[model samples]
Target: MTISDILRDSDYSLDLLEKHIDDLTIFQKEQKSGLTPPYTVCKVRKKEIKLTPEEVVRQLYLIKLHKEYGYPYERMQLEFAVHFGREVKRADIVIMDKIQPTVPYIIIEVKKPKLKDGKDQLKSYCNSTGATMAIWTNGKEIVYYHRKDPNYFEPIPNIPSQNQSLKDILTERVSIDDLIKIDILKTQRRSLKNIILDMEDEVLANAGVDVFEEVFKLVFIKLFDELQNTRKLSTHLEFRNYGESDSELKVKIEEIFAKAKKQWGGIFNDDEKIRLTPSHLSVCVSSLQDVKLFNSNLDVIDDAFEYLVNKTSKGEKGQYFTPRYVIDMCVKMLNPQEEETMIDTASGSCGFPIHTVFEVWRKIYKDLGIEESHLFTAEKKHERALEYVREKVFGIDFDDKSVRVSRMLNIIAGDGHTNVLNLNSLDFSRWEETTKDESWQDIYFDGWRRLKKLRSDKNSDKSYEFDIVMANPPFAGDIKESRILHQYELGKNASGKFQTKVGRDILFIERNLEMLKSGGRMAVVLPQGRFNNSSDKYIRDFIATKCRILAVVGLHGNVFKPHTGTKTSVLFVQKWDEKLCPKKDDYPIFFATMQKSSKDNSGDKIYVKNSDGSNRLDSHDHLIVEHDLYNHDGITQDGIAEAFLEFAKKEGLSFASGKCESPFDEAKYKALLDGLEVIEINFSEVLIDKNIRFEAEFYNSKIGLSDNFLYGDDIIDFV
Candidate 1:
């Protein structure tokens, strides 16, 4: 039986989906007529069935899951039907072998605001259908039911975490065996509910809302005592334990978590259980899933509170979660391994670390059949990579809450290493102090130990240090104050400090180098301001000489959330020995740009084919939808990879040929262009080519700004 026919045969999800489809149809029709239709409830009859865009999205996710698992829809039919004769709908989604059709292997019920009791629905459905296994899911929370006897269903523990895609499932990128061993499936509802409740109690107790608020206050007050003297929380920030019955606050918090779930690549239906309200003592709990204790204890209570307060205040924009696609690209390009030590200096929400961890896990498990016991951990049962979490991964953030969140995220990703520390990048003293002390002796520690060690090392002319460093630093500062921006700028004197602008981005580059060993690779997100800006010439020149600029990938604005929108670029480099002074051809720079193309001439059209001419598009296009880069192709999209790979190859070729330092030679480059014309023109022309390169002379209005270079008293320039 077809999926549509099966689902329609038994459940109400189809009806709900049909409602969405009807609305979408109306919306589409209105758009065609240049009209804006008002939002209204839409209904459709079974005979005139249509899938809503939302339903299509959910189906796509399901399809992706199947693809990962190597299961084709042809072999599986999704069955939805009602359970007990209460006219109650249940089993929103069920997977059965199309051949059998009568017996369902698995059943899933998704609850929304309109369809509550998703869990109960699944229970009833399993009893009625005799499905072997049933899942009641609301995205964030899922409860699994296994048949104990033919008539009864009992919960099972330790199902592996869902892979989120079909490919990951099919390849066993994350093991189902491991999932069964860990009893992840069993951890649902029971454990999750208890944990959430305890967490809520703890949060409410602290921050004048829960039992631990006082402890958290004490910790913060002590840590930032000096800043306390200057700009205390009581002074600059406020602590409010919203009173009971604050429905608005609850709604607001729910909205926030909902958005966060969507942004983080987790899906939530309307029926998902969420509670947002201040408790008796006033600590508010707003959760996307049902109430559960946030992992807590007095010692970690402050950390939790800090995360909540900061996360709530900063919201989604502050942490700036990097898109999975962008992170995927970085991981693919760098190919982070278990042996290499990786660090993200400005890890906001620890997105890179999470992505890196999973990517690394996939590689390790695929080849060696190992699973991460914790972030950076190796299972004793199987052969694994090197031990010592601290040696493998590290991250730093200026925000204390970010550090806490990063730590928890690392733990979740199976990395035991929790090295995220709090310190401002601009504060040289703080940066030095934090990195030097393995114990990380808090704010009182001296910051110059590392600098002293560097000065005392006997082998100053020797080998490289770190493997890779990656970051996306803050980018808002002027270049006038050399001292304020010393770490980022080129130095004037021989003794201490690098001269820099007041901005933070350049400082991150310099700091990234300090973290790297010679010949180490690095990938960093930068503002386009670095390119073509007169002041940045020093940095660019320094990079040209000291490092191999392997690739420069220009990104679209709005890659970050709309609020944090800024045109950015990712610069991939390999630091080399300055003393060796390799030939220009030894390390040519690769440049790639993602530009808008006419609807008919998109680069993504042929993006599936790689250099070897193999189709790489078969891998999950997780980046496309997660990053919101889709453009009506009805397929997952990634247009930037082709250009990036092309440029990377060019850069490698230039290095191999030993002829990279030639002056900007347009004539030689022209021949290299495959029928693509390089347009050139002077100022005052009204017309402009959309494909013009930003670095091109004609694109620069001031290149030959003066009429003549020989003398100031030149004739009037032509109009």
Candidate 2:
């Protein structure tokens, strides 16, 4: 049966709703021939009932809340037919699972769709019953009110219900700790043994130096042993002197790599086959796997007998790890789901990847109610998150150390197969044969396959094509020895391209764009100069033409503490389709400045400056403010960043000030003075607007101020 039908039944007594009901706007319906006994269709009208149902539902919720809480609505008196005090009304049905009808535990006021006095009537009823909780609803939305004390019915959240059971209401009041005893974070931490074992397996299989080192050293010793018997000038005869010549060591390392490659099938292929020689073993010792793992104090034995290598090979550029909070904001904006394949081209330390894991974990456990234990390594958790590491995540970096570190970090974070590649992005040798001349072809190919797999069509539906890309590429970084830029046709003519003197940072931007599919979104940290310098025109034009800028966050100089003092700006852009660009001849772009609302004892509120030089500020010089920073708000130490982003979303406008007209136009002034009689008058004061005037009183005192003001036309040479 419908709730209204049961409530309107003649058998029910509304003594439970007496005081809270301010006015009853009742409507009458004609009694049909087959109608039952309960038919009270009396039209009732009253004040405080003008609000629509939606408004009524919201107000009713406020009525039950305590005063100290966020929204309290019970303070207002309930208006009744007798006229007691000011009335606050709520509408519809109320749930009172805790109260009994016979004892009058609580009361709720109900109102029909057209009834305006529902809240007033509910208030009066609350006063009459002295119940702590009350409710009002208009069927679609419901509100609950609870009294903190006898005098008030404070509004509380109307918990969604299937059946109004006391257990359900009590459950709502229980603390989160009461609901779940296990601490997911603490459980993961306690599983250090499993994490360490996993690390051991991973290091051996992937970065696992001991296994590969043993394999490489065995091959090395066997090759030398064979060479000794064959009298083949023993490859070992080449560089027995280790400490003397670094050059010889390099040449020996290269020769061994060559021999190792030849021993394997000549070129790197889809087949998982690798060969080793003495040089290969030595090179492995110098590889990133050897150095980082060998030095780790994770209680694992390091076997140097197996050619320990720690060399950060080709494209293994070191990258600074962006902080967690920064990644939080960036990833939140990117919002990648498990279904989405994420790619971080610069992939520094895999902060975004780690953040992605946490984000997915939150959604799976908290939002999806997938149980915190399911996120644990417990038996049930493994199957649910097993596929997450390999196909779900992708990261590429030129740094081999980054690849190893990123891979391990993810594995430790519970995703085993993190797709991190170590190769130079600038090298295209693997894609085209002409690029074979490159020295690091194998490393380049490793990265190329990873990139291709990321942008592949098969995975298109799994995630948005590069739904989010984020990075803080090097600042004023130069690539004097880049093999990638050397081959680019576009790099030949462009001013910022292919110049060794030009910063590597400039190239990274171009590379980042290439990595992104059209219409993809990106938030990259860059140097402040990129926003205004004319030298960056090529890059700026590319950004404007290719993408829609969502916002730019100007961070404070402090954001990079312990790092360099270089000021940074985050440019949030989404790859835009041509259809999305604004029409031509639109007004200059506008930015809304964001400022901090509060300050510390120092009185410096962190603020950012928009590129346009405007600010949302009471004062930038004397006072400062910091807004509650979050991924949603685009928080920066500086207030200007939010404004810059807002400006980008609007018209494509330059924030630079227009050049001032030359105040001393010598030639024009001379021409005007020669052709006409000129009169000069000096004024001490210049009035700008109502209530604002600029005055030089010394000059005004010397020459009495008059109504006539001096104009260029009337000016003549005078002392």
Candidate 3:
């Protein structure tokens, strides 16, 4: 039997254990009549023991202590005991001091697979035994901490080896290259969400402070600390705790936070201070110091902020941060150009607009022949990308907390300015009231001014001329106000009477359409029932009359789990124009259903794995989620987005290929002017009697109907 067999039922992996496997003795004992053979191992104890899941991890760690860390076997002890008050507890493993062989130098806890549980146990043992350092792992994630005092156990990158001092590890200088290579999120196989959860369990849960505000402050300060040393290759990150007193660390962090507020204005109050207690803040900084929050897409920070914001006001409105994979797919299918302007009306954390900036940056880099390194998204190296973000990207959200998060991300993308507004998008009639508020004007005035320049009419907020619109509006609530209902054509029925109430998403559908200029494209996430329900025919007809349906992609049910289980589909459409869309009544539309869920029912992400069951990393060393939405930068199989691009090219969609000035060759044009015979026929009469369906899945389900089949072609003989 192998170590994998012992860890089959646990969440832990064998990746860290594999290298030390040969140093230990692992064998299967003889099986009885009804019992399976148990894996046995002999290590630090020099005695045979049945290797349970926990024992397997402990044994692997012991080998690592001896071989990798240069710790001698004589210095290590298994099941070392210590007295706590009147009770005696045993630590899983302990490394004794070099000079004082009886003193505990490092205590490793392996019984608990979870970080919170293991960390608590380690803290208790360290306090009781006066151990200077501690280690905790479940074979998957490992953490090293130094016991600064009785109340605080600060996180360290790694424990010092046998010959090195803890000061060497604490004072080591690192660059952006080193940070990218050893990002805790990748090396520890832990997400920002998981780390936050650990911090909550350790301190924030009982810190007597607002969890959201305190954590946001820490993350904001840490991001600023990372940005400071991005260009300087030899500077040490100031976010960490390096033998400083708790009070001193807090002062240093608050100073950095103040600088961050000055650098990225509008997210926090000018007088705001980190409210966490000095000791509490010290532990939080240590927990977050090693994380590299900036990446190729800022997805690490995005995922964490999504959780924090959703816990407060977002869930009540049925809003969840759109998954980055889903955002990438939407951005890919839209094919937004650098010159085009884009906006997300709902704008939860501004996922759509921020990703659109990244997409445009890719194109700009390709044109300029600039090679992107691991710091491509983190560093502000391109002036044109920054200008595109500052000028062309905009977002609006009704939730104040979400708007702050969105604004922060947008500011990071643009380096200073942000166009993410905090006004309600559906209630545009009252936008003037919001604009007049001096407090709102102080932060959002620049963005609001830029947004006003794109309006189709200077005096109205009813229409806009943006080139692209993408949003996932709240679907669980209804707009009961008549004033909001009376503003949209969709709000009124066929009888021209405004409804008393309308689904929030329905109003957003109309609002999104109005935001786009003629020939502009949009992608909106809506309930799947809107596409297939017979009672929603008028809504479908309303869309058909105004724009050509480009595509409909049905998402998996678990895509928004833990917060919601609503089955949703993204509707892609392009407005009619004389040159670009031409009001086509009969056209082929692309249809697809995502096969991979990308997440489990518990809302945890499922990552792509290697052949040996370890998670796969991309060229940037970030874990790739298993999905069929799009081939993530060519890391996974070609998915639905790739197929749609091919179909778009074949159909010569205006966005895919430039609009043709003439429909005929020069010879054909000359012949037509020279009295060549021309045939004219009215084909509407043939199609007028047949029933038509606008739902993409309806056509997708029919047999022998290819992706390129024209509307009404099956019912009429076009030849």
Candidate 4:
């Protein structure tokens, strides 16, 4: 089988396979030689060698470097040895200097998908070979980087052309918007999560401490280092560089981490030190020190955590990171205004809450109409952004790791990590269990004080009143525990007795509703079965009694694919209100179904590409994907959410700020236009929906005044 066939047969991620196939096919087509199985011709070696899985990746990249990147084949070698500390190791592929063929210029490590972490080996090779530039790939994900002096590897967006110098890659900066445009990001990119996973593989797997806790600690220290080295008004982050030896760097890093621990409080022991050996800790510091953490958005961080945790931990619980574009559409359709209190009940990585913070900050940042490059310090934007987060935004998750992650994102979003709590959303009755921590009380006292004002019970926020709520609660398991089931309305029978089991999402529905105030809006993703299953009618009834079902927008089946293909829908509702959601309930409801949710039938994401095969970006520098679910990005010719809003306005839905207009006389209008033919209409929003419609016939004048006679007293002369 060809190299492409091997990757495909491996059953690795389809996205990874597709990317490798594209790169490999182009290289193979350039060769006019033996590419078949028994022996594959090496374009550089100018001879046929046994085709192995590792050889496939090496050969494919060799052609890529030679043909596409303009690296001369004469400078490339099949087996290049470098002297490690005690032994000489051969890298899979190495490129030599143009003038000095014996000196290594670039080193590449190629492996298969199942080989979990190749970064450490690549780092070692680069260090030993004195090759400043190196690449690590597993025929799937690739990381291209250039090592700075003294052990720092800064990521390069891509490998440069032969004529392009390495400095060319370092000078360029990518925005979060442009970063999302790279579909290959999921396939061949380096991230903080990958580094953590690498550490787990190389060090923490045998370390005595919990892997999650240790990774969290390193990340915490890294974040603090980034914070301490902030640029003007905290506009940017500058990473620490070292000229010291590994042991010296270890001591210095531990000192910095200790300072961070004391400042952050509660997450770790006050005297906590780096748990890994000095050499391992030094290696990690060197690997991570140059990465610009704040250059991109939180989605990058979330992708890392989701990837690292999914394999060993969260995947079994059916919790996947919600794609950012999906979260953006929900935020757009919901239209959260500034200062609105919001909460995400099942806040995995806090995407919904954090994006809502982004939405609000965008408005506040632009209200003056000034175009500033960066926002928003905890003290910038009048510190209103931080105030809004502290008082108005909240998130909760039962999982400690998830809660810690959720808190990290919020802390970066604003100085409001305390707003995120680690309580079981479904078991609100025992929320005191989380609140009882005196340290938790110390950090969260102010935010909890604001929350207490909304509670029906002064002591607990079980009946808390939030203006808006959005969540994608976990539903992998059933609530078989009787004590947990006893609290939810969905856990009961018609006779008011508790049932032995209930879906976790079913209970989330009850708890989420209880959290909202009268007239508050909610947009939540639920399994489509909850909307149509015969046995779930009671769940629907429970919702109906508590709120007005304003909209039931059926999400495309592929929306959550490659994660869980169970069809789901975002059910939008408003608690029954005297003005917004009527108790009488005869009003017209907005209905829509997503035509596209970015991913295809096989769950492979199809990002729009340019003629040169790069991701197509937007005016805002965002990588534009096929998100026809909403008109927020204008990726589609027309969107269902956009059309539904127009329909809601025409139907005079109260929540839509709809105006009642004069009824149209269809027969009279048709008769008027019958002879006039085609008409152009323009709706004026400034006026009360009055617009011009004209039918111009070629047989007559454009206006055709004679055919359109109105014999009024003022126009008596007009016949």
| Residue 291 accuracy (lDDT) in model 1 | 18
What is candidate 3's lDDT per residue for 603-646, written digit by digit as tens? Answer: 88889988867778899888898988877877787677766665
Deviating ranges (above 4 Å) for candidate 1: 1-287, 290-319, 369-388, 431-464, 477-488, 491-501, 578-581, 585-588, 595-639, 642-719
Which segments of candidate 2 are over 4 A away from where they belong?
1-318, 371-385, 430-451, 455-465, 481-483, 486-500, 578-628, 631-719
User: Which ten residues in a row are the worst by lDDT in model 1?
Assistant: 710-719
lDDT of 1 by residue, 213-328 (tens): 32232222222221222222223211111222445544544444454333322112334434223332123221211111111111112224434444353443333545445666
- Which prediction has more favorable lDDT, 2 or 4? 4
RMSD in Å for model 4 = 12.4
Model 3 residue 443 lDDT score: 92
**Which numbered prediction scores highest in TM-score against the true structure?**
3
TM-score of predicted structure 3:
0.90
Per-residue lDDT for 92 in model 3?
93
Question: What order do candidates take by TM-score, descending?
Answer: 3, 4, 1, 2
**Candidate models: Cα lDDT each:** 0.43, 0.40, 0.80, 0.63
Judge candidate 4 against the unseen true structure and give its global Cα lDDT, from 0 to 1: 0.63
How does model 3 fare in lDDT? Answer: 0.80
**Per-model RMSD to reference:** 16.3, 26.7, 7.1, 12.4
Clashing pairs in 4: 142-188
The deviation in Å at residue 584 for candidate 2 is 8.2
